[model samples]
Target: MTDSMSDTLNNEIIVPTMAQMAAEGKQPDILFWVGCAGSFDERAQKITRDICKILQHVGISFAVLGTEESCTGDPAKRAGNEFLFQMQAMANIQVLDGYNIKKIVTGCPHCFNTIANEYPGLGGNYEVVHHSQLIQQLINEGNLKAEGGESFKGRRITFHDPCYLGRGNNVYEAPRAALEVLDADLVEMKRCKSNGLCCGAGGAQMFKEPEPGKKDINMERMNDVLEANAQVVASGCPFCMTMLSDGVKHTEKEQEIQVLDIAEITVRANGL
Candidate 1:
């Protein structure tokens, strides 16, 4: 990792796009699919950089789609706009296949689910894994061990499974697998794993405002975090991070509790 991890890309870190690699007659080991949030959202971009850092740390050959990348059509599909989804999906598939991309790794579970599950049917078959799963694999392979990691012993940590990652795709253990690598006191909210509660951002709920007069779903979910008595809430999705962070802010837990994406935590734990 370089000083540019928190800022814009710099020469110190080699972050070539698929187009650049292809133009150079190169094929990276994996296509890092930085989804909408990871690409544009300021906070999510930090997680994106951390993920890139981790891949670089492990000496994995990877390239991002960069200017060529498009939305995986998750929000459109989740919002019940199939036509728009197909259009977006096809465009992405064309770009991905043009680069001869075979394996993909994403920071967003929505992209992971859409590309891994939906793209195959549209003639875009490829192996896709979320960053959490990749982190688990890297740790398992002895490539990453969080050598100089932070141990949240005093303020226990808990993981909030993204709805798309958990129920939509049944990825229960990977996020925890990534978080557990750190020497931290990890716990679980009452509703976790298969029974995890949504952070009020699933099915494209993130875009529109919640219906008036109803208690916000994220607020209700934050109650679970409070009950767990966790000071740090680890999540794997950027959408969930926004909602959870809003919850912490709404409840005025800024100084006491914090919401972090798995990649961010991994970067910090490993002193990346």
Candidate 2:
């Protein structure tokens, strides 16, 4: 599927929408579900571009929903509005069904968890995998290589488990496996994997202020990152990326530590 129809973004990104592919009589190998953050959040958009770069680098044909995409209704459901959530989910499922989408890959765990778990009850059933899982697959299939990993070689790095991606969905290895290829010194925080800590961005806390806590959740999570003494903290979720990056600024460790999404790291390591 080297043939693709692309609509230019600010960066000249060649991201074809499923709608465009359908009009061209072409179906992508998978649908890249760029969640709200990946679509609009400035920082998350960079991750979105890197994910696009990876997909292209590996020759995997993919397309996004673009304007036709709606929220997976994760925030609505989390905020206790089942009606709104169902409405949003059904709308998105209709779009997917229209395109006959059978597989999906997304950068946000909230979308992954919601569409993979909750959407099925609303008639949205498809093979959904997190971006990290897809990255691991690419590496295992020998399509992606960290040939330009000089930047990460011998550097201390730690992986933060997004609640929805890890504890919420029991995905504890794919991201770590992807990171292992970087040839970087990998470390673990105090709470990781199944017992991972939330970065406070979950449950729609990202759109509002925290309700009185002893310490901000990201700060506490930052403490674990600090304890790990990792020069770089790798995250999988955009919300986690935002919260942890804010945590870096809050703790004034902006100079000491760097926050990066796993997809961003993969792009760098692959020299894309």
Winning candidate number (lDDT): 2
Q: Mind sharing the TM-score for model 2?
A: 0.95
| Clashing pairs for predicted structure model 1, backbone only | 149-269
Q: Model 1, range 24-106, lDDT digits (tens) per residue?
A: 99999999999999999999998898898888777788999898899999999999999999999999999998888899999
Question: In model 2, which residue pairs have backbone atoms overlapping below 3 Å?
Answer: none
lDDT of 2: 0.90
RMSD of each: 2.9, 2.6
Q: Relative to the true structure, how large is the alpha-carbon lDDT of every model?
A: 0.88, 0.90
Tens digit per residue, CA lDDT, model 2, 1-272? 24321321132458899988999999999999999999899999999999988887777889999999988999989988999999999999999999999999999999999999998988999999999999999999998889854478899999999999999999999999989998899999989999999999888898888898798999889889999999999999999999999999998998999999999999888667
Q: Cα RMSD (Å) between model 2 and the true structure?
A: 2.6
Worst 10 contiguous positions by lDDT, candidate 2: 1-10
Instruction: Name the lDDT of candidate 1.
Output: 0.88
